[model samples]
Target chain A: MENQEEHQAEGVGRPGRPGRPGSNPEAVTARIRARFGDASVRDGNAVGCESVIAERDALLPFMTFLRDDPELTFDYLADVTAVDRLKLDEAVRFAVVYQLYSYKHNRRFSVSIPVPEADPRIQSVVSVWPGANWLEREVYDMYGIVFEGHPDLRRILMPDDFGSYPLRKDYPLHGKGERDNFVF
Target chain B: MGLEDQLQENVMTTKVDAMVGWARKNSLWPMPFGTACCAIELMATLASRFDLARFGAEAIRFSPRQSDLLVVSGRVSIKMMPVLKKIYDQMPEPKWVISMGACASSGGVFNTYTLVQGVDQYIPVDVYIPGCPPRPENVIQALMKIQEKVAQAKAN
Candidate 1:
């Protein structure tokens, strides 16, 4: 126990430790709304967590601000994924989600961008977070969402020759005969 | 008349086919193509507790050319099917295949687009052992069945 206390004392002010400076959900939402205007950002209905829905056009700039700002230093890009809301019958067909973590504050934030089915394209955040390369590629492979300006964008999980995105709502539970047509 | 009746004193004789079959059945080098949980059971069978060496099949060879029996034990996905076929093709002739476990034999419960329904669609299987992951005893029984087949083949 003495060793643990000594370790904690030595580890103070480092990333991931408790009792460091942090930002609340309301503060984060207010800052984003102030910068992007109330029309571009709004509070999301995510229970027990901080989530904000940003317009497709404002995603790149918003992500940059969230990372570069001193108070909201969301430096870590935890994950990039998408949801197919076909059954929900929402105005937008897909919602690309980004999970971010601020090491200074040791808090988490979620940002989502609604994408229409006709275009199905969004600005790539790889410039701000280089780790989004594979995560964006995975989203593209599964949900067929195109990430503009992403380097070396290609299928990451499925085979290279696979035709359709399997995670799409329209895709059948069983594959469309891809498994049966092997050359061997 | 038996060959013993025709043989002279202090001499022994037997058919060449019977001798070859007996030799092949006694010493089977198995190449394990294990890919999932079934592989754990396969390891148990090879360890001292089950001791697969008792059946003269403990010479587990990694090289396809050096082995005669291919024990495919686990799920085979669509992406892995081509690779599995290549391995099976590399094995020399007079080879036999034992598809161990439900997944290897009939794709088990994973009836998905990614997983192959059965490996036999690509390769000829001589024996199919049932069970999600067959017990070590089941593997021994399958080995005995393969030996029976080998001994009876061309012995008439």
Candidate 2:
């Protein structure tokens, strides 16, 4: 499908999306600014606006709006990944990445939320995106990030009895002391 | 057909048989369900230096339909056992399988809960190339053995 047709197909998309009568990137920018205002918005080179490096409280609402928004039409959540930011700044220690695909607009947006180390609780978007079930389980297994409403959250890649979160920054990379050593 | 008909056809009377026969004779395609590092050596055997294309086995088809041989390389995991069975089931009849490397031939070093001890636990293996990781020359020799097996079957 053509790019613009996708968003219109979603419902009524923002003016910034292609082929919309009044849509422009600036207009979408205005709509975004109007919703969460100046403080919540930050730009990233990799993805688009709606990038909302959202706070923990802001996650569920923003995700809900993105799902319900006719103009933005971010109907599909493609992937969710966790990045442990322990050394970068303890202020917000982990990044929960949500990749949203707009079927109507043939466009994509990524929503990142930063969770501080003290209280690493974030709402599960599984209610919003069915596919987030496995993705959230992976994040929970690897980063130990607590998803508040996940029904069947458990360790995935590693064994159930495995003690620690392996992907976290502090987890030793030596791989359980099995490394081969060569004589100097 | 009958054994008498098969014996007479083994005689090369046509020019087409010599040219195409050389290809059908030497070029035996290998399809490996490589689940680990031993797969790298399998690729090396078909690379430019070894040049398995000369023997007409270089075309590595991913699907079982066109493949003449199945090379079960590396350690087969338990989760992967069903997938291997599915792939093996998809292959045309009269297919041969080579159990390449110790992992596929036996269990090799990864004697863990997840890995299947050997591919032969699920499917018949025609030749077993026993090594931590066999060299390309060993792969070529293994192929020659399969070819001899094919020739013997034709005689029978």
Candidate 3:
């Protein structure tokens, strides 16, 4: 019991430690191992979640595989959001995260794709998930990332004439005096 | 009891301006442009608990053309400013605006990009009710103040 308590204190758990009740982490981990190798997959630090870091070029193909493969079908595109990691001391300045879920398997996984600061552009996944339309537009509106080939790509939250992306680290919390010029 | 006798008995001496002012003050139709938590308190003021009808301003009209008083009772975001201004413009002449709450009068706690500093910058305001979410009593008092202003209006 003391040794078990020490292990808990050290924050050490066995490989493939069970996650949330409904989620079958073992199944997701096994499939990721068989397909993308162990290097591509990691325990997401968050319990009940697993992380898969996919290459930019392989993003669409991997997402397609995850959706089509019967054993690891992550059919639900829960959300598409981005994090502005400008001051986090990371090589890739932006990280676009895709939260996915498998209704059939009753499991969930998160895929994060690191994007660089310069020429931030990514392939539009609307063809794969129609729901990604507005979500991607919102990401673009906030992060200023271009989702190439996004049909009707426009600002969803901010005004069309709004210049700066509000969510970026460089943008001011009080705004850039643009809101003052608005004629009511 | 001929026409000459009836005219002397029925005629009463009163100023035309005073009569007009009396009508304006007693029959103020309010437009409640409530958008936040203050809206709930505004509703309470209108409800039986506070009974706003006693002031003769209980007729809550959503259409700006039908209302003479705009009871702005919450934070007004920048995006919402244009709409608020348009509604104010649509209100008939001699209309008064009551900014009810900290957010409405001075942007309250949300001194941020999305919120306007104060609604008065966008539209003319008559009464500024000071409170985070002013109690129903405060709303009643503001209404009384508007009634005073209406009573003092001059006829052209």
Model 1, A42-65: lDDT tens digits are 788766557999899867788999
What lDDT tens digits, residue by residue, belong to model 3 across residues A4-85? 3443443432223347443445556567667777776555544457776666766677788888876666789999999998
lDDT of 2 by residue, B1-156 (tens): 766577786664545535544555576767778877778888998899998886778889998888879998888765566678888889886678999999887778876544667778778989999887999999888888887776545311
* iRMSD, per candidate, in listed order: 1.3, 12.0, 1.5
* CA error at residue A145 for candidate 1, angstroms: 1.3
What shift in Å separates residue A53 of candidate 2 from its native position after superposition?
1.2
lDDT of 1: 0.86
DockQ, per model, reads 0.63, 0.05, 0.55
TM-score of chain B of each: 0.93, 0.82, 0.92
The DockQ-based CAPRI class assigned to model 2 is: incorrect
Regions of candidate 3 where Cα sits further than 4 Å from its true position = A1-18, A21-26, A37-43, B1-12
Give per-residue lDDT, candidate 2, residue A30.
Answer: 48
lDDT for each residue of candidate 3 in B1-156, tens digit (9 for 90 to 100): 665567795776567888888888889999989999999999999999899999988899999999999999998887788889999999999899999999999989987777888899878899999998999999999999998998888856
DockQ-superior candidate, 1 or 3:
1
lDDT of each: 0.86, 0.73, 0.83
Note the chain A TM-score of all models in turn. Answer: 0.86, 0.77, 0.82
Model 2 lDDT per residue over A1-184, tens place: 3644654554434334443443443444445667889787666445333354556686778888888876666788899998887787447778888888777655567677887767777899889888899999998887888898998898776555555676888877543421211111
